[model samples]
Target chain A: MKILIVGGGMGGTILANNLARRLASELRSGKARITLLSASERHMYQPGLLYLAVGRMTPDELYRDQASLLEHDIEFHVDPVEEFRLDNNEVRTKSGKVHGYDILAIATGSRPAPEEIPGLAENAEQFYTEESAIKMFRRLQAFQGGRIVIAMGVPHKCPMAPLEIIFMLHDYFKDRGMLDKVKLHYTYPIGRVHTLENVAKWAAPEMDRLGITYETLFNLKEVDGAKKVVRSEEGGETPYDLLITIPAHRGMEVIEKNGLGQRGWIPTHRHKLTMEGRNNVYVLGDTTNLPISKAGSTAHFEAETLGENIAAIVKLGAPVRDYDGKVFCFIEAGKDRATYASFDYQNPPQPKAPTRAVHWFKVAYNKLYWASARGLL
Target chain B: MARRTVDARGSFCPGPLMELIAAMKMVAVGDELEVLSTDKGSASEIPEWLRKARHEHLGTEEKDGVWHVLVRKAR
Candidate 1:
């Protein structure tokens, strides 16, 4: 069996590591092979960027060498796939090499497309990338503090990020003793404060307690940088001294170019985690249009199930289980306090009040993410 | 047979639970397993999983902040 995993993000890394471990004997006997092709040599703890934007974490702490995180038996390469030939069960890389696979898992994650909205990218501070995160931090530092507006668009990759960043901003400003001078405003594209009803219920009060004002049903239509204002699709406008945003996200261009999915999100079978029509082709994480949060833990849990099933395919010629739509996310409420939501298709998460213990756990997990990529945690 | 103990003390939610589930697959029916976790979430989640998976719940105890959830493979 030949397994080709594209993209070394959370889902791909965990799946590759999990499969390598489960098929150790098969790999040793030359009965199975695992090859991972990634666009970069480093794996990033993406959630750390939320902290990075707020100066809680440094850049160096968010990365690990991708090769070092993989098992020794796995064949790893930095050649990114340029073309996907699903018809041939192969992919062509940027280096003009074609790799064939008996099984293929696509984990090409989403990217923040602030460029989708006019003036939004140029005016708003976003923290999706290393450069942008640092830039956001610098912008936050120089702010004289009037109103810091957090505007959001539909389908942001990490849906919880805008909320988390807003909370962290409260702490960051409080730590700087600028709480009285700064007014925090948040706007979401949903009917509620959050898409998750329970999370909205929990967070609305938290926002109120912290004196953070919010507007629901507000979408990022455009930003008029000259006026220092953002206009919503609902025909409302909010002025800001500083604008921080979680822009709408789109999956990789390669996926779109390959016609694998619309706007790069492949239609996937929710329980099977397979491409809607293609059995041998699998989709995970933000690459899948599953109507779930594109959180790293969603990818992690999906990888766990995909790994087990793929390993079973090698050992038993059939998969044994289903994905069950499980997702878990830790919501950082504010300074030294956190809560989490764990839910599936059938269950909606009712996040309890924030606690210091859960906050510490999130702090610990930031360092432990490397172990998780290696499928140890 | 003595009940097997899976020490997951340092791991958090889903980590300890995933470890326990992975270990359960290797054990035989009627085999007992104990999951030791410090995660408050997993301590509660494990018993719920046992109930849903139709496994026999032995007991759960918390000592010094670590939760010990015991179960027996029913099928």
Candidate 2:
């Protein structure tokens, strides 16, 4: 069976590795041809970018050469996907190359589209992407004294990430002997500081301790770059010297252009990670609008299931296994401490709980995760 | 003499752990407590945590897609 997987991200790479192990016989005999395509040579651990923004992790630590991470059997194409034809089971590349597949996996991840919001793209700097994070870091470093605003965009990955960065920034300035010279402001569209009110209960007081000013329900509409002003949906304007926007996110345009998006995300069954209304197509990682939060740990859990299910289909045609939308994440709160939140989402409301020990647990887990990614653990 | 049940099903990982910590706070010594966790990780995590905290591990069983982890306040 010819398996063509688009986007060599955390999901795509893990799926490829898992398939290689599960279908070793098919892969060795040339019966199964696996092709993984990506737009870049570097596969970055995006979650690490938050640490990079605050000088906690180096850029080199956040990314690895994709070819080095993959097994020898899987064919790697460092090219962008132009279009996909579901009827023929073929995907066309940006260079006008088309490849056919017996089965397909589209893990093409999402990206921030600042242009969707007028003036924000041209004027306000963003910190989601690697380049933007690095640029914002430089901007932060050069700042002698001024008002710094960290604005949260809606539906972004890792919902609590922006607050973490802001908190770290507060700690950063205090250490630099410029705490009083700079004023920090946070603008969020949500009713609370974080996703859960209980979380905000803890985080709000932390923000207060740092003397940071935050305004909620302030939906960012536009930015007047020339005037250094941002207009919110509530007919209010906030001016700043530096505007670090989280920016809006969407499924990779290729998925949308090919009619893959059901509701701004690839529609997949909760348990199987298989396209709900389609045959022989599976999606993992951030592109799928699952019930859980979009985070790297969710991708890992989904990859573990989808990879096995696909192999079963290729071999014995076993019924697909289900993914329970498990998410394990670390919410970094400066001082080299991180909180681990594992969400097991099911039907019927259940009270949520948070733990302080999660801070140390995340630090230890980070070491293990990177080690495992490099095949060391 | 009495048991307290914390329904943490439908919540995610550390959610069950947090519930256990909170429940331990309110329960008297030797009181039984049950945590219904939907997260598979919790099945293992809770047992390990209880052992470390010197609490008595009653048992764990999967029911209706959730793991019912029962523990007793031993400390």
Candidate 3:
């Protein structure tokens, strides 16, 4: 069996590692082969980007060479996939090289679609990418204190990040003795601060205590950088000295170009994680059009089920496992305190109060992330 | 009962933990290493790591807003 895994992000790496470990016997006997295709040699620790934006981490600490994360048994290709020929069971890369696969897993992650929202590409700052996070950090250092808006578009990746950024800002300004001068505003498209009701219940009181204004149902419509104002589709407008936004998110263009995606994301079975109308192909992580937060932890959890299913299908001819939509995320409150929440499709997350212990756990998880890619954690 | 002290103050989460792990690699078995960190997570995480790694955790103490964690390399 020849398996091709696309995208080297959290989902791809974890799946590759899990499959390689579980199918070691078949792999060593030449009955199975795994090939991982990625566009870049760099594997980013995305959660670290939040700390990077606050000037607490450096870029060197946030990324690692992808080669270091893979084992010797898997073939790693550092080439961009140009298109998927699902009808022929083949994948074409940007270099025009074609690879055949018996099984294909599309783990290609999502990216910030600033173009979806007017003026966001040019006007607002974001922490979703390494470059933008660094830019936000520099801008934050020079901020003289005024209205700062952290806005979001619906279905964005890492649903908890904007809230974490706001909390960090609260501590940053308080430490600098400029908390009184800075007016912090957090705007979301939904009716609540968080998608998870339990998380919102835990976070709302904290936001009130920090003196940060939480505005709900304020979907971003346009950003006027020159005028320093942001208008919501609901006819609400807020002026800001600085705007940090979680822009609209969409899957990679290649998926859409190949007609394998709906609105730039591959449609998959909610529990089976199998691509719709394609039995040999599967999808996970941000690439799938699932109503789940596009977080690294979500990918980690999804890989657990997806990996087992792939192994079973390869060995026994059918997948036996089903995904539960499990997800957990650590919410950084401020300073040294953090909280955590865990849930699945059936149950809402019950979050714990912020504490220094949970903060450290998040920190340790970042370090363990390196080991995780190799299937050690 | 520490022969070396690692000050990981002003650093964030895994920073303090990484420092302690690096310090442990340099010390001899049965030798003690103390970590001084301002990151509150270190107060709990360092001991957890020590227990998992099979190292002897002496204890953790807080002084002047800093956490002083003691660990002995137990081989």
Which number leads on TM-score? 1
* Selected candidate, larger TM-score, 1 vs 2: 1
True contacts recovered per prediction: 0.00, 0.13, 0.00
lDDT of 1 at A373: 94
Candidate 2 shows a clash count of 9
Cα shift from native, residue A60, model 2 (Å): 2.4
lDDT of 2 by residue, A172-291 (tens): 888899988999998865445764445666778878877898886566778898899888754568999988888767778778777787324787776667786778788888888554
Q: What does candidate 3's lDDT look like per residue over B1-75, in tens digits? A: 338776656433113555565355456888898888765667876776576556788889999979999889887
Task: Report DockQ per prediction, comma-separated.
Answer: 0.01, 0.06, 0.01
State the iRMSD of every prediction, in order shown.
Answer: 16.2, 15.0, 21.3
lDDT of 1 at A310: 99
Which residue pairs collide, candidate 2? A271-A322, A271-A323, A338-A359, A342-B12, A342-B13, A343-B12, A343-B13, A344-B11, A344-B12
Which 10 successive residues of model 2 chain A have the least lDDT summed?
A: A347-356
Tens-digit per-residue lDDT, A90-201, candidate 1: 9999999999999999999998889989999999999999999999999899887899999976567666787788899999999999999999999876455775667888
TM values, all candidates? 0.83, 0.77, 0.82
Once fitted onto the true fold, the runs of candidate 3 whose alpha carbons sit more than 4 angstroms away are B1-75
Candidate 1 docking DockQ: 0.01
- Colliding residue pairs in candidate 3: none
Worst 10 residues of 3 chain A by lDDT: A188-197
Q: Which 10 successive residues of model 1 chain A have the least lDDT summed?
A: A188-197
